[model samples]
Target: MRRLAIPLLLLLAACSPANSQPAPPVGTKADRLLVDKSERVLIAYAGNREIVRYSGIRFGDAPTGHKRFEGDERTPEGRYTINGRNPKSAYHLSLRISYPNAADRAYAKARGRSPGGDIFIHGQPNAWPGPPIARDWTDGCIALSNAGIKQLWDIVPDGIPITIRP
Candidate 1:
């Protein structure tokens, strides 16, 4: 199953087109972010205007369903905030996602499990020896190319609402 995901992710990145290279340049910063898991697309919105759309997003190993517990390897589904940014992260750059809302914690606790946290929308691992994207790899956070993340890092500010949908 894991082996299959790697190839699928590689294909996903290859086939999907990225609109991150918006021409004419965007003049305003993004106020919200939207992730469509089925299409592997992330869109940033300034007010009602769509600024950029990033395709071929990589996810966790499972790549299905809302994350319920630690080690589920499932990208979470719901609304969250860009709580913080990491300039000195393990990845090229990272914007922390605030997962495990109160509801998530309650659900996991009911099942005697930890609801897991520390998710982020980030780029490739720093000092990685392999290609930029060898796999759709992360515990359960969103992954993007170095250039894609750099573009996002420049436009998206902290405390913006981000919604991840199935």
Candidate 2:
């Protein structure tokens, strides 16, 4: 019995979750993304721990209210995912955002309106010979600087969950 108890204790100790190493900070990797429209901030996180934060995000041209229809120019407000990526995007490298989830569709259907699509978090267009716009200026996508988007493209990957808020 004593020998059995010693082996059991050893096995339990080895399987303890607390024995795991601490998770690396936000820069190393991320499993989640969050965008706050009002504050104009986007954040990446690993579980509940925030990995990084990016500010100065540009939103849809309307820039107020939840997106409801095609050409509404309002950034959506809800939970979504990074569905895909476009390295050859018109804008400098973009990550596709899965908007118009079931709820969005339902809302549009109920109201007999068309739910807009093709939302993304992308950088500025390449070779534009002008200064950055001072405020919200997208069709219905989130905009970041070319440098910022490139950094995010490396840090975030496909299928990560993202939440957008008003």
> After TM-score superposition, what is the CA distance of residue 141 in candidate 1 from its true location, in Å?
0.6
lDDT values for all models: 0.87, 0.82
How high is each candidate's TM-score? 0.85, 0.80
How do the residues 1-166 of candidate 1 rate in per-residue lDDT, one tens digit apiece? Answer: 9999999999977765453565316657899999998898889888898888888788898888999999999999999999999989999899999898999999999999999998999888898765556456788989887788888998999999999998
The C-alpha stretches of model 1 lying farther than 4 A from their native spots are 1-19, 23-27
| Cα-based RMSD of candidate 1 | 6.8
* 147: Cα error in model 2, Å: 0.6
Which residue pairs in model 2 clash with each other?
26-51
